[model samples]
Structures are given as C-alpha cells and as structure tokens.
Target: MQYAQKPELYATGTIQLWEDPHIAKGMLEAHLAPDNDAASRNHQFIDRSVKWLSTLSPVEAAPKVIDFGCGPGMYTSRLAKLGYEVTGVDISENSINYAKEDAVSNNLHINYRNESYLELKDEGLYDWAILIYCDYSVLSPEQRQTLLENIKRALKPGGKLIFDVFTPYQYEPLKESHSWYAENASGFYKDGPHLCLFSHFLYEDDVYLDQYVIIDEMDQVDVIRVWDRSFTVARLQQEIESAGLKLSAYYSNVAGDLYNEASKSLCFVVEKW
Candidate 1:
C-alpha cells in the first residue's frame, strides 16, 4: 500500500521572530510552561487579580469573562477553576489549537476562539474582560482604542475590564544599538538547532527592534526581525476614558501597589458605565 505524502513544516508569514507563527508559538509555549520562571510570575499576577475579583459580591449569575490574546489558555484555565465562565480569544490559530488541547488534557472547560481583539464587540455578553501579560501594548495607539471600545460594548452595565501595559521606564536601560555573533556546525539551521547572530536596538520613541540570523550546520541560513512598542500611563488613561470606561484603580505591581514612575507595568481596572 502506498502512503500519503506528509506536508512540510516551515515558518509562515514575514519570517520575523514576532510574526513567524512557529517562533511565536515556541516562545509562548516556553513562557506558559509550568516550571518556567515567567509562568510563575504570571501565576502570581493572576492570583492577585483573582483575589481582587473575589472581593466583589457574587453576581446573580456567574460573570462571563473574556481573555484577550489568551495565548495557550494558561490564565484561562485558572480563571475557569475560579468559577468564572471563561472564553479565550487569540489571533493565532496555532496558539488556539494548543490551548484547546492543553485545556482538554487538564479536564477543564474553556471557550477558545481564534479571533482578533478588533473582532470582539460589546454584545453585552461579558461581565469581565482581560488583556493580561502586557498584551495591550502589543497594538498600535489606534488599534488599542478600537479594542477598548469593543470591550466596553461587550460588557454589561458596570462590567469590568482589566489590562496591563509596559511603562516608559521599561525602555530606560535598553541601548540604541546591540549585536551578537556566534558560529557552530548547527549554526546554519534556520528552523532547527543552529548558531544565531542577533542584534537589537531600542529607540527613544518607545519602539524596540531586533534582528536575528540563524545558521545550521549545512550552512543554511534565515533571518528574523521583531519590533515592539511601549505606552505611557497618561496615554493609556486617556484611551480608557475615551472608551467611556472609568478607571477604578491602577497598580504598579501585581500585588496591587500604587503606580510609580519606576514601575515596569501599569495594570488598570476599568469599569464600564
């Protein structure tokens, strides 16, 4: 009997580190790994948010919660266990697939949707919305405002929306130019074990750029680029107000401390009118 041919596995999209689905999936999976330090930090942040949610009186019905950019459903599973009806929305199909599989393995029920935040509108369907892990900063200023407006519409009256963004201080230590070079037999591999030469630069305008060249043992090579933007507290606050949401609180740390200039993250709780 003849066997069917298997499909080739290769990076898709712009080949940039941030846009390449394969690399993005790998990075997200690593961060969501249970034993990873980043995962531990994320859990602590979620715990603190859950604690705050606990203080609110139980609604007549369980509040519907949406996790924006919920990569692999790490926090989605936790929120489901807390008795909240959880829905995780992600732009990445690969991420959503992995999240669904992970949720099934854990015997947890979560609604995982492959959709962008821009597509989520206030259908009066959710009581709480979350854009955790500094996901809000992932969008441009215009896109951010659009997302907030959609979240506002999705919430019921007095519903809550919470999100985090990196502060201006996050760019303080990053230099304008940095580079690295390495070589090895495995270095020529583009998608496998390889030596990588990398360079990164942080601009004064709150944008960061990185470029990487991977070389495998066979001398094969590929290049990847990445860019990220940071937001200021004032700008974020203005956007929140423009969305018709009231900023209930701002925390500098996951532990609910007041925001300060030195804080790397700006966590906000906003209530929809």
Candidate 2:
C-alpha cells in the first residue's frame, strides 16, 4: 500500500476527483442531471437560486458576479442569461474546458478560469462572490481563512460574498464506516482491476475525513483523504468576523429559510467590512 503523498494534517494528502481525469469526466456529466451526485444539485434547486440570490443582488442592472467553484459552469451560464456579468472558476481542467466550450456554443460572454480559487489573489472587482453547494465546508481552517480574506479583498466596498456550509449539528454521531467494491468496468478509478477500501473518520468537534485506499491490478496503491471541516453557527460567525467580514445574512439553505440549531445546512452572506 502506498500514499500519493503525506497528508498535512487529517486529509490533506490526496488527489481529489477535481484533479483526476477518470472521476471528473463522470462528475461533469453527473452535474447535469438533478440529484445525480451525492450533493443535491437538482434543476429545481438551481432555478430557485435566481430568486434566493436575488435577495442580496442589486435592483437595477445586474450585479457583476463571481461564481467560485462554478463546476461545469452550471450556474455561470444561467446567471449570465439572467443579465449578470459572470466569471466561473474551477480547479479541474476538464470541467473548465467543458464550461468554456458551453459558453462559446451558447454565445454567452463568460470568463472561465481553470484555477484554484483558494490561490486567487484579491484581484476581483465585482458586486457579488458566491460559493454555493456547501463547498466552503470542505476547506481546512487555514484555507478557509485565506479564502475569506481573498474574497474580502476582491469585493468592492459593501460587496456581498455568499456561501453555504454544514453545521456540526448536521454531522453529529460521527460514523466510522467502510465499504468495498470489486473491479468493475466503470467507476471513479477505472484504470484496471483493483481492490477498493473506502472509509471515513470523525474527530471530536473537528473534521470529517473521507479516506480511500485503492489498489490497482498492477499492485499500485492510491490513498485519498478528503476532509470536510464543519462549523457551528457561533463558531462560523466568529471566523467570518476574524476575516474582516460581517455576517449579514444567514439561512437554513439557499431557499432563504431562517436558520437555527435544527438546520443542518446554513447559508452565509457576508459583507467586506
């Protein structure tokens, strides 16, 4: 058994699906279908976003928007059609390519960048920055800080940055489990016949780790550690304040329902202070 690399902490040493060709190709296609991925990104949910996000948008002309982790440009093209200047960014080369092609085919003017949003400098001049689908919960503490600061610098004065995150209530009763599958013709790692061991770990009040150990037919091992960092409402607010951002809006979900302890998912809309 071998690891791609040593993890920095819990699950930092892994090649995510975003960087894997075999996985990202399937992911892009899955993104088109409603509720295809583990995450629920159904068409109805996405279409409703226009109204949900509009609560924070300007009234007159469309606001300049930046879609962080804009996967396959799903929301990017839709937002553009709704009359907003949009820019989509993702880490996957395949996803970026597909987004770019779609934009061209549709004759929509959207700037698509194949880059890591975490490494993005404070170089954007936009009215809104959105990171939907609870992508914010996956980053480590340090990365989350960097992301918040970067978004703060990128937004114009009074600009709003919105993103979703999972609360600790949503991840209680930490489950340590495992699953396996025999080599099949199709899967994320489709190189050849392989043994797959999938497992998860939860640290007390810390992070949820989705760890994978795969052995290919050639006896090659691949270890993947995907960490999902969760937060409590109070804790998240404090972190946002530390980043020099003001939490102006909080919701149970993108649907705009009021958030509370019972709400597993929370949407936060912050302003650069």
Could you tell me the C-alpha RMSD of candidate 2 in Å? 2.5
Worst 10 residues of 2 by lDDT: 1-10
Compose the digit string of candidate 1's lDDT tens values, residues 78-121: 77777778899987777788889988998888999988888875
Error of 1 at 253 (Å): 3.1
In candidate 2, how many Å is residue 219 off? 0.6
**lDDT of each residue in 1-273, candidate 2, tens digit only:** 223223456555446767888878777778877766353378778878767787668535437999889988878888888778888888989988988999999999999999999988756588889998888888877888888887888888888988888877777776877777787655665566777887777666567887778777777777767778777778889999988999897888876778887888888888987
Clashing pairs in 2: none
- Give TM-scores for every candidate, taking all chains together and pairing residue i with residue i: 0.78, 0.92
Alpha-carbon runs more than 4 Å astray in model 1: 1-13, 16-21, 35-45, 56-62, 183-190, 193-197, 213-225
How well does model 2 score by local distance difference test? 0.79
Model 2 Cα shift for residue 147 (angstroms): 0.8
Q: Scored by CA lDDT, what does every candidate get? A: 0.69, 0.79
